[model samples]
Target: MDSHRIIREAEGEVWVSCKIPGKPTIRGSLTSKGISSDEVPEVTASEEFVVQEVTKNRITVSCPEENISCTFLSPYASFSHIHEKNVSYLDISSGGDLGVSSSTDQTFKVWETHNTEVKSVLEGHTRDVFSCKFFPSGQEVLSGGLDSLVKVWSVNDGSCLATMKGHRGSILDIAVVADGQNVISSGQDGTARLWDSAQGACIAVVDDSYSPINAIAVAEVGNAVNLGSPKETPSNREVGTEGKLVVLAREDKSLEGVSLHSRQSVFDFDGSDAFNCCTFISSVGVLAGGLDGNIIHVDIRNPKSAVETVSWSETPVLSLVPFRDTYVASYGNGTCYIPLKGSEQVLQLTGPNRQPVFQVAAWKKLVYTCCRDGFIRKYEIPDLG
Candidate 1:
């Protein structure tokens, strides 16, 4: 045989084909020992075979002529009826026991991680809730809504604890500073604001980009990059805001970095298209997703250009989150991809049938995604640390 091919059709079926020197192409379903060509005399190229083993690291296929193995990732579980409309965003708690989701149905929900049972229904937003996240303590949720308001809710009782208002337009995304004392929010008003979670007051307008901010991520970038000093004395309420970098994804096709303490622009990189989402993969490395499906990886130390650009599809990239050494990205096509950090191998999670997966979150070995199909799918990856 000169060449052979193996393709996974579904959960347990793998298709295999090989070209022989003289005779018709040999095709068969994989058996315990090898491909049983005799048992499947009329096997077509599209027919699926049985794979020997499928795991997080590798997939092994045994054949009489040769053996084939490769890495594969797939979904293992799914949860339905979590919302009535498209689930716009979701975040898993640091404890990995709870999850919170926001949807177009003008509602927010907190659920159990194991079975996705509804724990509490967060109410108060007159419009759609666009973003929601759990605080580090896992006792509260911070949410931004189309009503141009940011609110904090108690996880134990589902009661609205605080309602923060300042932006003139819709609140698009949010980020919590170190601990749970302060939080940052981006809005359609073209500004990012730092707010005291306990007092419900805006500490300062961190940056007014003049372009609608779609998403924001905060991280302690350390002293490697110049964060600039504050022009005025920071308010005493600004807790744990020092040396933090806030990255903004804007509608003007710009990815900008700002100092949380100094409120200074650190760096800016123009993107191929309007940015929709962004996240910090490391202290100094950031990933920004664009409307044109480009995921630009940038190093703050040298922000003149992207370190690398990758695209999984032409569909818009909606959400991004760091998962172990790799990152997870969702798209408008209802697909999620896990691109390994240093390899060409890409794992796919499919279930919503191209209905637009809006957000994805990871906790330990489990991955949870919310889609336009009104379902929250949970995948348990094997051997995932």
Candidate 2:
């Protein structure tokens, strides 16, 4: 099989694409035993009732701190070393190159796992590039920072392509919204700005909050599932792109988060500030994590709004990230990893090294956490466990 070819499952059946001419396809049942990240036993199954085949390979999964080892195999390359300077965010490009924006070094590094070397350093963001990502086509780079500027650069030459302004305060987060044509930016400025990605211009300002918007995700609405184009824009419309952003506007000066849609705070008050560090479950329309270390599932489609809420902390919570439908919340005291519909047993990871976690990003079963102690630890996740 050609390692580069796609071999992932699509429907009920397992899939394998053998790029090599003489190679045989690997096939099996998709039943993997589950366990917690700390090596605790767990029941493993696909909650959706669709059982695909799981394949085996040469790689072994290990967690030194937990003293756990398991046989695991995958088609893609695995990142083995822990990142330096507490990785605040880890983004993967289409080519699988990693963009690790950090606070420890106060710089963004581009890494290639094949060479195990940093290919380039995105050195423009003066402060931490809190949110950095490649465009959908992976031709350009976009980053926001405490510097209050959103910079776009060419992926090939690494030269500045365009700089979008208007963020009065530190830009905490950003998203390539409106189907890659527009960029949605949120910051301490208490407003979410919609910017023209190609023109590097601010189109509209969604000023629904007096508090900092920690995160914003744009989702296409019905009929307007597409965005405003330059040539196709209406004469009466002020902005070109018009898509709904699922923004988590944290209340003034704290973790109090509000779920926003269509430039309005529709769902509010779940915690001291759950919306501040919360993340929306993809395809599920649930907002997870807020104040009181709890995650609130707000169904935007529902009238009552409050669908479900889960408390993972007593201490002031910092962030909540979704690993599939399940989520992990980082607080001052500990980190709680939970699955929604299946496992009730909360996987708690706490230690001397586990300082207050500020932000977290997970890939596959690997987690990258940024802490106040200025250290980042990578741990293997128990997907089924």
| Candidate maximizing TM-score | 1
- Residue-wise lDDT of candidate 1 within 294-379, one digit each (tens)? 89999999999999897766789999989888888888877677765554445666567768889999998888988888888787
For candidate 2, write residues 43-123 as lDDT tens digits. Answer: 222222222223322222223322322232221233424354555665556554554445556867666534546666667
RMSD of 2: 13.1
lDDT of 2: 0.54
> For candidate 1, what is the lDDT?
0.80
Clashing pairs in 1: 14-49
TM-score of each: 0.84, 0.66
Give the C-alpha miss distance for residue 352 in model 1, angstroms: 1.7
